[model samples]
Target: MKKLITVFILSLLAFTAYSQQADRFRFQMDLGAAAPKGGGIGALVNFEPQILVQRNLALGLRFGVAGLAKDIVYYDIPKDFTGEISANTSFSGTANYYFNYKKGKAAPYVGAGFGYYTFSSVNIESTDIDPDDIGNLRASFAWAPMVRAGVELGKFRIGAEYNFVPKSDLQNIAGEVIGQSTNEYFGFTLGFFVGGGRWGRFQ
Candidate 1:
């Protein structure tokens, strides 16, 4: 039993070392559209700088914001209250798992992670009956799941990710706007990795 345990420990250490040696460092940026299902669309942009913590594991930060234009149509209303909504700036973080097909200059990967997105908005154009609406939406504890397939070129990386955030309330608004929405932001990142090492995080 003692010999078996010792061998197991040594094997674990070797695996860890191998894993570290096989990792790639990268930085990414993405831009796309934040299209809401409710006849609203916005420009979505995100910048992510990531550190390959280990094989298949990456830790990063995402900083971006979106501006949504409202295209609402009223049927029973006397006057049409058509206006656009500019979503306030919001932020979030990310952790991803990269599956690099090859350990070359161009490595393609796919992974997913959870995020917390903050959304806020004010009435861009309101009808005459609509008061000076100071709307603030709070979806603080939001879930962000994303799937990305992109190529990593040396210290710079470029790819597109389809990020989805679960439906939350559009704060400071009248009506329960609780549902899921898509971030629709595609990233094109350009940054270099420190501590030059071989990309071999895949064992």
Candidate 2:
């Protein structure tokens, strides 16, 4: 998390130094799919609220969640042990800093940040275990890196982004299980912007 903050500060300084050359503030909304590097479907939708403080720089908060699910009737593990696994979802939020570059109406941007995600609804079944044996898993808080790009048309904008959340073991149903790692992701977005007078804010 500290590392993520350090990067954001450096990017903010760089954008501030070059933002005086542009006009107008920028905003955006985005949706996309997230796939787990180890397991789970890479499906998701994201709505990001952003403010372009400078022509070359912007800062915003990403408020949304990512989910992964699959249905299994049987399993083959170290033993013949198996039952049924249903679905799971992960939620995340973070502060994002973007460095934007542009010419005329086209703008491309990239960003990175850190956030926390909660993993829930991970269920496994076995004939030896009762239905009441199922329980919720604890949440994991970790550092994540994200990247995004977009285009500006008038007061409206369209873009997409991919957020990568690394795997970390903060808590688990089995009391801190190890060797279980996964990733979370976000795909595309659509958004709008207002204010900042005539100084290209989203430039």
- The number of the candidate with the highest lDDT is 1
Sequence-dependent TM-score of model 2: 0.56
TM-score for all predictions?
0.55, 0.56
Query: Which digits, one per residue and each the tens of the lDDT, describe model 2 over residues 1-104?
Result: 34434554564455445445445233344545555443446455544434455455556555455555432221223322221122222223333333334334
lDDT of 1 by residue, 34-149 (tens): 55544555676665545566655676655555676644333234443444445434344567655564456556566655555555543435444334343443333455666666
Candidate 1 RMSD to the real structure: 11.0
**Model 1: how far residue 41 lies from native, Å:** 3.3
Where is model 2 poorest over a 10-residue stretch in terms of lDDT? 79-88
Q: After superposition on all CA atoms, what RMSD does each candidate show versus the true structure?
A: 11.0, 7.6
The reply for model 1, stretches above 4 Å from the true place, is: 1-26, 70-93, 101-103, 124-129, 133-141, 170-203
Best by TM-score: 2
* Residue 163 displacement in candidate 2 (angstroms): 2.9
Shift in Å, residue 29, candidate 2 = 1.9
